[model samples]
Target: MLYRDGLTREGIVVDVIIVGAGPVGLSLALGLARAGKSVVVLEKDPGLHTTSRAPIIWPRTQEILADLGVMDRFESASIILKQFTMWNADSNHKLISLPISELKDQTHFPQILILPQHKTEALLYEALKAYPSVQVHFAHEVTGLSQDSESVRVRYATNGTSESEMVASYVVGCDGAHSAIRAALGLELDGITYPLMAALADVKLPYNDPNWVFPRLSVKDVPVVAVQIELGEWRLILPFTQDESITMDERVRLSVKNLFHQADYSLIWQSEFKLHQRISPQFALGRVALAGDAAHLNSPVGGQGMNSGIQDGALLCTALVKAIDTRNPALLQPNAEMRHAKINFGVNQFTNILTRVVMLSKGRYMPWVLRILNLVLKIPSLRQKFLMKLTMLGD
Candidate 1:
């Protein structure tokens, strides 16, 4: 439920204060609430994000949702993708296809689920309503944060007007890349910003191609990644050199036309974003911690960003619950270490390689690289390993 002014409970204590209401924040809140910890989620926005940002939920993240008992809700609303195909645009030749359905014996939700970020947040919010220990405060922007020996004090404003303060044992930041909490703590995210800009759009294609699930096509030197989200609607991502002269809409239209050979698709939403591969210097600073995009950001090539963030929430929530229950803040360090390592080696490194491969596909060494990749993918064991890595299940 949306919280208002009096819900702040100034002098009262809360176990945790989540500083964002996005998927990661909500997921962490839900998990903490289910664990019987008092949670207060503070969001700057008045409502859920409407546009589709992250659309692919991998197997590992689905497992986390299942454990939270919200997988059924997601399964009812999302589309199950059984396979991912890679193709050569010039020759229309299929390079390799990873059959996700083959892993049914290993996982309950073996395949990725294509659902918008907004829908995921809605489901998590609905699940949060079942727990009395959780309260989500919308339009409450966190302005100042300070902590002493006992608890963390968070100062926030309602609609940038009335101000208030609350105290929690710990504060978690699941905010996006420009996280206010992270900045307030003087934490630095160390990594490089890619020179290329990626343009993405959700559009309704004129034709339905059932085989279009997670297809990567290289057309005219541009790398196009397309996936059928639901029904005839598809999400396309294309990486290109930065061009300030061209408008995002024009670039998206041209890219779509070049990739699909059709300009009749109806555009639902479009955006252009710069890619970054970065991780926080530390996941936690005393009683304040970071999760989701606030802690790390990676390439969108393998759809790992959102999944990693959700996983971060799962891990952080568990640690927070344990720390609160045992009254030992030391319990939080293990999770911080584990998540930082995973993001550095597991998520960041993997996505960096994929992004480099896609970017290098426009270079002179791509053909040889593709040949080697095709050869390696021919081995059943190697293919399985690759699938596991891509699905974020390897680590």
Candidate 2:
């Protein structure tokens, strides 16, 4: 029962204090509350964002969401994507339509789900109502944190003015890349930011294709991704050069025209991003832990960042409860190790290579890569192995 206005803050310690009320944080809070742990969520924002930041929910993520018992709402509201087509702009032909059916045996959700990140956050917020043990405080920015063997102390502003204090048996930072908690812990982010910049736009257009997610790569230029978020609204993720100086709106308009061959479109919401593939040296630094972009970052090319963050929350939920219940802090170590290893050698590395590979459409070896991809799609065995990597079910 979270009211939008104000949260009741008694000076009492809770089981877990989660930073950031985005999907990852909220997902962790939900699982903790369902397990009967007292959970408090601290969010800097006033409410759920109006923009669509991350829109694609891969099959594995859908399975996690389904386990939370809220997939029906998302399935009813979003467009279920069955195919991903990579196009060869140089040859003016599609290289391959990815085989999602091959994942049918791996997961019950064998398809990708598309919905704005805000809507997903809202649903997670609403679902938290069923658990009375959870309290979500909006517009509360954490300023400082400290822990000593037993409980962690968190200091934050109630609404950006008055200072408030609370304590928790454990705390996890689900904040983004610029995490205050990560900074307070003095953890170093050990990775690199990619050279390419990306722009995402939510717009209304006459074009409609809900069955497929398309990314067109030019042997002479960078690639472009087009996805229909809903029946009338499309989310276009277009990359720009590092030195490009065009207005974001103009970029959105030009991308719509270039990709869909349609000039009549209205840009509603948009955001610009400098892509990065980075990971922290450690996820759990003592009683404080980092999740989501706070712990790791990957290219948006594979749509793995948010999905991985949600997976982090899901994995952390169980570990946190167990560690708190058993009074064994060492139980938390394995989760941090697993998260770091799976991403560093797995998603982070793969997406780092993928972000570079896509941008190198004009590179010398891109055509040969595309040729090999075509060959892979033709054979079921090879295609299934490829789909395992693409859908992340293999992880």
Candidate 3:
């Protein structure tokens, strides 16, 4: 159960075998490599995604990127998010606008940045090149995972036919939801999947409004959130209540036009999915740990899922580097415990409440909830506290 001077008894060169090469896994790989740890990334996809998913990067995460030394490059490609506004869809009345500029005194990076998830992943991957110890294997899907007291073993298939094996001191899963690593470890998500089917789309609008996030609350129909991912490219998330439309393309257009009153916009890409407010009871089960969607699934209402995953990756990297350097096997437990508490009670719970609130369109409690929210949001002290939580400045 020892490091054998860096490699395992079977001559495995990697210190950590990271399953999945999304932002979380890549960030962890980059962090470990920067600290002089040998790591490998195994991704099921042939390459990085082309579309924009999970677009908002919070202030706290921006600081983490600065620590990793990519903020300068990231800031160039990303747009600053100015404010988030809530509105009544039925009457088009503005309820509140929370300006992100209010956090100027709290941190150097005061506002959130809007950059697509794919670009973030690519940046993290690019940063790993400075360290020669990192290895990335794409189209290599991890099929089985086994661990002993000393080391963990991973088996993955390349091109879906050829199989190979590798051993490491520790293995981490950033494989995302429906993770093969998590399933091989026999862990349960333990939460609720929303009953309504949700649809998300990225499109080109006729006009430019890149600073605002419009959350349209509806009593007559499902709720919608429309925000610009780039200069003129907006992303929309709403309930999918499709009828007998001839084509999905037509349905997407009809839905957006009905809700946003936009007469002309080109749809770039669209997808339908289900949201789950779920989490694993433990972040790590022995030496094999989980991060990102593999460990937790947020509602996507407040864009917390990817942020939480990136935070998880940074913490895991720090913990494992220390553990490997000092040869302390117990360091991972405390790291996992701290992450569980921080995310379970913080991001996971915060987005869950937001998801439920946005869906309460025609409920009887709407009047009471709005009255209380109006009174509470009027307090500067409370709003500051909320901004702290929303941006996760403390994490």
Candidate 4:
């Protein structure tokens, strides 16, 4: 079968093969390639665009990117969020406004940087593109997979035209939630989806607050959420428009039309997203392994989806490097068991926080409940505790 470069009468083998070319896969490729491993990335997309989706870059992810020597590039194209403001929509009273200044000196990249996911991917791909050992083939989709004791054989087709096979010592699945690799490996993804389907949109608008994201809290505490993103974009979470068949455009339009009463907002992008908390049963199954959304998927409440994916890229690379350096190479086969647990734990934490926050809006006691929570938030110790949970700094 034809390999990446071309047909090799003599089968070619690589040290690692990565699926998906988003930030996660590109990050993983950079890590493995820098560690002196031969890495190839297969992307089903034709090319990356400036995606307004997932622009929030937390401090931890910034630190990781900085280590990879691309933080400056990212900073050039993003905004740093310094404050989180929560308001009581009824009274129009500011409940609690928290600034990230508290995390100063804690992380090298202390502020939350906002950059479009496409821009982030562009930077990552640029960095990895310099390495001759790493190659990325766009429009290549994995169609089949077979693994043996020694290596993994991946079957892929380009533009639905030709078939090819590539052998690799290991494979990493950084694909999104419905990962083809995860399914091909026969790994079970267990999780529960929240009753509400989220509506996400990006658009240009005139706004006064430069660094604040105003999210609409539950009016009566039913675990529903409506959040505004960046300066112009907004997100809404409500019961699926069809209860069972929520089309992306329908959900997006319904969310906007309901909130704005008129869809005057110019939409640049729209999607119906579901908040699910799920994790693969394992991270590794022999030479094939999973990372990022393939390993775990969660709600976008705290902007943890991409952050966790970046962590997956960084952590998986660390594990792989250790395995490669070990005396027995045979001991290394995608340490799925441990990675799966870590990813699952991360997902649960986000879900729990989101659920609790939503639950606080329930019932007639909301006025008193808000007062109490606000009072508690004023206490420095309590605020710090809350910050730890929200930022996952405690972990």
| Best TM-score among the predictions, by candidate number | 1
Residues 234-299, candidate 2: write the lDDT tens digits: 777767645466666666666666556568888788777888888899999778899998999889
Query: What do the candidate models score in CA lDDT, each in turn?
Result: 0.82, 0.79, 0.78, 0.70
lDDT of 1 by residue, 39-110 (tens): 899999998888888989999899999999999999989987787666655466776667887777768878
Model 2, total clashes: 0
Per-residue lDDT over 247-269 for candidate 4, one digit per residue giving the tens place of the 0 to 100 score: 55555555444334355566677
Error of 2 at 73 (Å): 1.6
What order do you get sorting by lDDT, best first?
1, 2, 3, 4
Clashing pairs in 1: none
TM-score on alpha carbons, each prediction: 0.91, 0.90, 0.88, 0.83
Report the CA-based lDDT of candidate 3 relative to the real structure: 0.78
The lowest-lDDT stretch of 10 consecutive residues in candidate 4 is: 216-225
How does residue 141 of candidate 1 score in lDDT? Answer: 97
Q: How many clashes (backbone N, Cα, C below 3 Å) per candidate?
A: 0, 0, 0, 4
Model 3 misplaced stretches (Cα beyond 4 Å): 1-8, 86-95, 206-222, 240-251, 254-262, 362-375
Q: Cα-based RMSD of the predictions, in order?
A: 3.3, 3.9, 3.6, 4.4
Query: How do all the candidates rank in terms of TM-score, highest first?
Result: 1, 2, 3, 4
